[model samples]
Target: MLTANAAAALLDTEAEAADIRTYLATQERKTLLRFLTCGSVDDGKSTLIGRLLYDTKLIFEDQLSVLEQDSKKHGTTGGDIDLALLVDGLEAERQQGITIDVAYRFFSTPKRKFIVADTPGHEQYTRNMATGASTADLAVVLVDARQGVLEQTRRHSIIASLLGIRHIVLAVNKIDLVDFDQQAFERIIADYESFVSDLDFSSVVAIPISARHGDNVTSVSERTPWYAGPSLIGHLENVEIGAEDRARPFRFPVQYVNRPNLDFRGFAGTITSGSIAVGSEVMVAKSGRRTRVKRIVTYDGDLASASEGQAVTLLLEDEVEVSRGEMLVTPESRPNVADQFAANVVWFDEHPLLPGRMYLLRTETEEVSATVTHLKHRVNINNFAHEAAKSLDLNEVGVCNLSLQAPIVFDSFKENRSTGSFILIDRVTNATVGAGMILHPLRRAANIHWQAMDVTKASRAALKHQKPAVLWFTGLSGSGKSTIANLLEKKLHAAGRHTYILDGDNVRHGLNRDLGFTEEDRVENIRRVAEVARLMVDAGLIVLVSFISPFQAERRMARDLMGDGEFIEVFVDTPFEECARRDPKGLYARALKGELKNFTGVDSPYEIPENPDLHLRTLGRSLENMADELESWLRERGYC
Candidate 1:
């Protein structure tokens, strides 16, 4: 009854649907690889990524047509088709003819799916490259054949290794410019291998190719007959990514406490390592509290088991003390639990890292106050040598010992990156200042414990019949901090009020004699004075700390050490010109003539208190009047 044409059309439609189903099934099973391109300025990082996308047939005809027009407008490639435009999508990057921000692209071959990051090549953009490298499994470190291995090449390689990128592809780009000479390629490879001998890359594969033109990129090139290595695409598709994370111990960082109802209290997080089943036992890595997983809950339903990278809500069979920022792991695989540790830090802030400054240490789910206790050494990128350094400047890498306010769960970066990595945030500005990777616990953190005392602060204050507080005096040099502090202490002593003055100059002569007047030393000076003042306050004495304390960061640190409402900031506001004119100790003259350094109001800066408890204008007020006013403030608040 049906015509031949109708029957043929129906059969063809059914065949097409079957083919589409098979293709989708195959695509879903393909493995994915994440990588990044990095090197020095104009080393073809972006161009290399663009070429990969193009040679893989990911670009469209319309895109190629517009690329021709953009090439003319940008003149980056002399009116030719600029393949780099495909990945360098930012208008600023195109205008400047360089990559600035990190650009990400996705493409796929029959064997694997790829996500590649095109990172900037300039030194200032090292942070951007680091951001890209943090998640990459492999790094395609491009090098110009003519220039050979450069400083940035070495720096990127070092960072890649530090970030745990085991596989490295050294794409010797612009090989055509070097006349496809095998000797030039071999020389660059020799230098790179020699430098990276100290690094921790599992494999280093060097290939010669011209990214601008399609030579040895997707297939073997006839020009490089001496080279026998696989093409870039071939090597990437065949590179074996280890399944180490799954084989290692299980680690689940509890992101949130999900208590949807009284009937269910589940711990929700993405399993960072290994696997967990419905009946598997997990222990609190820090506390060693054991519990069993009752159910592995997901949106799709309860899973019998879950592996690494899967987000699920785990219902425990027994009640346990678990909180956010804690890690649940295998019973036998307990992680390091300590408040003090050593780490490798990459400084990103323009403000140099002051050793004693308090910074916010932010891990995966925890944040605590931490300070760099010591700078062991800074690594010289050029020669991979260690050099002594007091502070870490921008783009500098150093190893430091850090002391945290509270202990948190962690593992060494080599074992588990998610739990082992952290970022240092400036407390005042909340700006991310540095990124650090934990090496190991300090061992002292475990041995030392706080000793309990029978005499408490409350008991001491009751015995003295007066409230203990810290009167923090801050001002420019010759601005009457010491003068006012000395007068206030005398008044308090006369009134039978126990008081002590930790004068800056006097303490430096004894407690801080080893410290210099450098910025780092100044921070340490304030830190030591703050600790002493805290102890004096604990002993029921009204502690008066007189220091310039020019930087706000240290002042805030000192203030944070005190109890709420117990720390009062007294600002002695003397005009800079007036303070310089007084020059009471002749120190200002020496400072102005370059004989002295780190002198507040001359070479160093003073950050005035924005909201001081007592603002005394020294331009007109006498010392006696100011001291009288200060004593009155204490009396009004019932301190004396």
Candidate 2:
């Protein structure tokens, strides 16, 4: 190694200094690697990061002095310099000796520049770890030597694999605590390999190190004479992160339409994958309009070509109606355009995900109304098993089917992360609640299309000389909803009104025969009935629906399907005690005897309607009086 004084003297010549500057500049242009550290709590994740920075001489002299003093005052290493203090920068973290958020650091060696994300180890912050791993090229998962492979180790490993991390380094830390025994290291490595056999990582390497003592961090350690492998920093600097994206088909999502003047019209966005050249044939994904590239424009100047990750503007030779939220791609290779897809999602909110509730889905520049149509299963992080689930709670990973109000242009997340990933935003609060990766579009979404007709709802209603409407009745079981609805339909039919009645038990005998009494099935049951009611109203008939749709979310879903003033929610207000005492079918008695499960009034809950259009108390009233009251209200609203 050259001395400091000699190195300064060598740079004294102007020509030599210029040559050295050129060499350093070239090194700065090398490829970058993004990785994160993850493991169980107190597994030395921050210590490993601090050791890399300390051994590489990246810390300044003043910072080192402060670190030495801080070590004595607050460090957990017992009077020695606590390397972990370098990474746990937050005051709370330093005081509590834990990492709660994702901390990012930037540094460079001669071979490569790195952006390291140190994530929390607690199970509560698993969503935070997923956020860090979304864009990572590799992962450094630490395992304590004494603990060997743990449940958290498996959790982080499975998450890293799910996020498409190609490389993984198993750093068995604190080997010095075990006297650097070769047998201990081998046992940990064997245990790790056994669980990771099902993962899709291209490379998995093991290294033994003592992060507190700075052993085998940046250089090879002499303590482990039987081990032969590159150090942690060596492998990071030399690992080959393939450039497969550069070879795939070009994809550019138009973010803005730049029309500075009458002479120019350009589409501005970043090329997310592959490259584009002037005069190449391109297609607008949303409109399926083909055009040739006329020019590539950038702030620097016009260019003949642009590659992946470059943000530029392109002018088309032919006039095309391309706008924001549309995609530009090669005609020969296009992504799937569909309104329904299957995806892997990680829920991040406190409120659990309930099906049929509308949420905002944003992918790239497109934002559309979406709903969780079905929850297929949730993954068991411990053993990678799929368990049946109706809803996803906080920090749960599940495979779900999503239904969007409009189609979007996207590729599989494995092919292009930029276009294939999406997030769910709560519509009311406008908060991001979940993140998802698209697996594939459902085959039926591509095969089905709405067939248009000349005669519409307006024409049908006009021909019938009446407005179409849906009268929805909701209440607890054993209530008089079915009785009142049947009488109201009979009254409307006598008055020359087109009417149809869709009762709960009648429809369940055929349309919803396969569904059970679980909460998930209950939501689905109401959804099917609401859809059928909507179809009948579209045919210009006043439809009457009677069901004990107990959940408020399901009721809201039905109301949202109809036009304003078209859906009338009638709450048949009858107390649960009154209904249980009545027990018209003896269902509540059976539930009380432990002969029935999921009985609405006996076991399950019934969410009362907060604000119903019509609240009718049927306990002390006659059926004819209730039916006449509903008929008078419909007549006053000009429905009959």
lDDT of each: 0.90, 0.89
- The parts of candidate 2 lying over 4 Å away from their true place are 1-24, 61-74, 89-96, 260-264, 299-301, 349-359, 371-378, 385-398, 425-433, 475-491, 563-640
lDDT of 1 by residue, 297-412 (tens): 99999999999899999999999999999889998878889999999898889999989999999998889999899999998998789999999998888899999989999989
Best by TM-score: 1
lDDT string, candidate 2, 1-640, tens digits: 8799888787677678798999988777888999999999889999888888888789999999999998887799997888888889988889889888888888888888899999989888888888899889999999899989888888889888878887999999999999998999999999898888888889999999889887788888999888899999999999988576566899999999999999999999999988899999999998899999999999999999998889999999998999999999999999999999999888888877767666789988899988899889998877788999888888788898999989999998888888899999886568889989999999999999999999999899888878899989998888888989999999999999999999999999999999889777887899899989999989999999999998876787788788888899999999888888888998989999989999887788888888899999878888799999999998888887
Local error of candidate 1 at 428, Å?
Answer: 1.9
Candidate 2: 10-residue stretch with minimal lDDT: 240-249
Quote each prediction's TM-score: 0.96, 0.85
Candidate 2, TM-score vs. the true structure? 0.85
- Candidate 1 ranges beyond 4 A from true positions: 1-21
